[model samples]
Target: MNHEFSVAEVMTTQGGTMCQYTEMTDAARKRVRAMHNWRRSQLALGNVQNGRNNYNCSQAANMYKMKYDCDLEKSALDYAKQCTLTPSVAYNQGENVHVGPLENDKTKAIATVGEKCTHWSTVIRSSEKKGYPGKTVNSTFFQAVKAWWGQIFRNGVNQRMIFLQNLRDKPNAPIAWSQMAWALSTRIGCAVVNCQSNTFTVCRYRQE
Candidate 1:
């Protein structure tokens, strides 16, 4: 006698395979929990925390029994094997990328969720030209400069005088030049101005 099955029949037979594998995985989890409980019990009985120490041989015997009965090592090996045999479609079903925001600012981190940026420099340059006020960069730079020097000084003695002097020779400086000056000053750790005519002087926290 010869036996053959149609494609639909074969698919129907294989449909239950996933349920079976799921049951096996559940069984492995149960075994892991049981072994963990047994280990906890042994540790509770004044046994040393070391796994290899043989000071309490009876507890060791219990551990060995649990290990063998649950076949924890073998179960782990089987689970790994199942992972390797997972269908590509199933494996890729829920694949997604997650990006996190910058540390201090919730609104300003450049987070690429799925694809890596290939031309980050161009992106940054465009943003700068477009006057994108990145919150994270602005906040961190502001805090660093504020901690090192007091407030941003716009008067004659401040570094802005020198920057404006240099810009005076160049073509029309952008309206954002002052903003750029502030950013540059923050970067170079110079945000304080000294007053020579006053007895009481304001000082900033020096954060060298």
Candidate 2:
């Protein structure tokens, strides 16, 4: 059903460029839909790793911008991300995310507070627990991916998740993170919510 309406014919692209956007063009909408088809095909062909798809948002967005010189736009990007994710096998097997560091690098991996912090993705990639809040255990894993994708590149995962969950009537409502859409976009959806909420600010500083 969703695949059919893919990307909502995403209303985020205009004049072959990205902007706050006013109206989406037919060509851009087709491109977005085609992207979904490609991802589904990749999944069908077993082009996945670690029990989930590796084709991530930032990667795709950056590549699109570099290759096309236009913003991939968050709405299109989120659709791309959501279309590709499948739950980890651990989640499917009734296993929770067991979020500890790699045993060799606990400090750099899980220490989000105090002790001279380093990088956010480092901590998140390592510490983000596999288990989710509320009834996510019973919901579709793709929706779970969207809910958490809302956290990537952003601080306050716990806070955001709390807010999102509170907005739900049931566990499923919060899982559809795409419904939030970027408030500043004509139709752009969130990539990682907003730039101010992103880890890039901290992570980039760490690199500097």
Task: Report the number of the highest-lDDT candidate.
Answer: 2
Clashes of 2: 5
- lDDT (Cα atoms) of all candidates against the true structure: 0.21, 0.23
Tens digits of per-residue lDDT for model 1, 1-208:
0111111111012222222332122332333224334433543353422223333312222221222122322232232222122321211011111111123222322331111100000001001111221222222223222221221122122221334454434443321222222211111111111111100001111101
For model 2, the superposed segments whose C-alpha errors exceed 4 Å read 1-22, 51-208
Model 2: per-residue Cα lDDT over 55-148, one tens digit each: 4222111111111112333333333223222332211011111111123122232333111111011111111222111111111212223233
Best by TM-score: 2
Q: State the weakest 10-residue window (summed lDDT) of model 2.
A: 199-208
Name the TM-score of candidate 1. Answer: 0.17
Quote model 2's TM-score. 0.21
Candidate 2: pairs in clash = 75-189, 97-130, 97-131, 153-198, 153-199
